[model samples]
Target: MKISTTSSVLALAAASTGSAQTTTYTNQSAPFTLQIANSANASLNGLYLFSCHAGAAIEGICVGGSTPISGASSTFYYNTTDTDVSGSDDGQGLLVWNLPVSGLPGTDHVSQSAALQPYRPGTNVVVPLFGFDAGTPVHFDDDKLTIKDYYNDANYVAGQFPDSTPAETVYNNWYSCWTGVGGGYTYEALSWVTAGVPHNPTCEKIDVIRTFL
Candidate 1:
């Protein structure tokens, strides 16, 4: 499994520059509850996840869960990414995207000084990766959080790798925060450990993406 630290592909997703984004509260799987909440001070726009079955198309299915975003907090179903993916058909992956909250009290766009932090509801714990400023040594919470779940759709089409590639699982938990200029963001690969159930064998690492958005 190959993971790239670039939002170049996700920049083409269906999202506006400064618009209100609608989100649905849904249960991810067992023991794991997906909470998408904007901070009180920060204006969060939207968080998007794209998945796919084959090719560079962002489409797939999330197996297991409950109704209306209320369920357990365990590792179960997995998210996916889009077309352009030319790897072994190892189920699906996720491309995570986050936009700033729209309509603030002042200013057109929130600067790093006034950036908001996204978090899981109730606990009031700030998520590690999604931030606008540099609180941690490494940061990706600057302007946007866009990710596409695929390795080499272009390379696959270019005959670089075989179609029947071996299927493997990969995890990515790094992000980039905004600087000042448009499309200008710094990269930061966060370091953390995984608890609860092991995110392998059964492909039960869906909590990584849904917890923020």
Candidate 2:
């Protein structure tokens, strides 16, 4: 959904006074793609983020080429409406997907809303869970375009955590991990892992970059 004009005016006013307000104005530099930076694999570098099903668990987020999933769109734009009732910017904004999800498959269940939530209860890994109509206002660092939760302030990572089968490994960090289910094989999940947690493979910190067209 688009940001309200009134909200834009407020943002401008707050910005003028150097007060924190939801800044919707990308200064005409929006309509950008999010890229995962500092990835261990060179191929994953500069690739855009997209939505995908995390093996029937939930409609989750993934990162890779333009079309990481069968009918998912990687392009996204900022929705700077003040979602926080506190009326503070604090780097709050919605990462709205460019495409509509009405016609996507039932299994896909993609929503424009880009939300970072737990894949399930009692798990360290935080998965990007979408489907909110108003869209959750994620803590979007305008300078970095990096998504962070307000609670821990941890940077989202693309994990290569091990799978249950031992021999098989999943690119995403979901607990019930398996491989070769999604359309793209190497499309990794966007997650947040607790610091100092041990894993066979470490999660790579991802940076979201803005791109034109």
Q: Which candidate is the best by TM-score?
A: 2
lDDT (C-alpha) at residue 75 in model 1 = 19
As a TM-score, model 2 comes out at 0.50
The 10 consecutive residues of candidate 1 with the worst lDDT sum are 20-29
Give lDDT tens digits, candidate 1, residues 1-213: 122222433232222221211121111112222222342312221222222121131112122223322211121232222331432223332222222223333322221111123332332212232222322221112212222232434335553556566443243332211111112222111112222332222221122234431
- Score every model by TM-score: 0.19, 0.50
Per-structure clash totals for the candidates: 37, 0
User: How accurate locally, in lDDT, is each candidate?
Assistant: 0.24, 0.44
**lDDT tens per residue, model 2, 109-165:** 222455555344454555455433234445444435544432431333468443333
lDDT of 1: 0.24
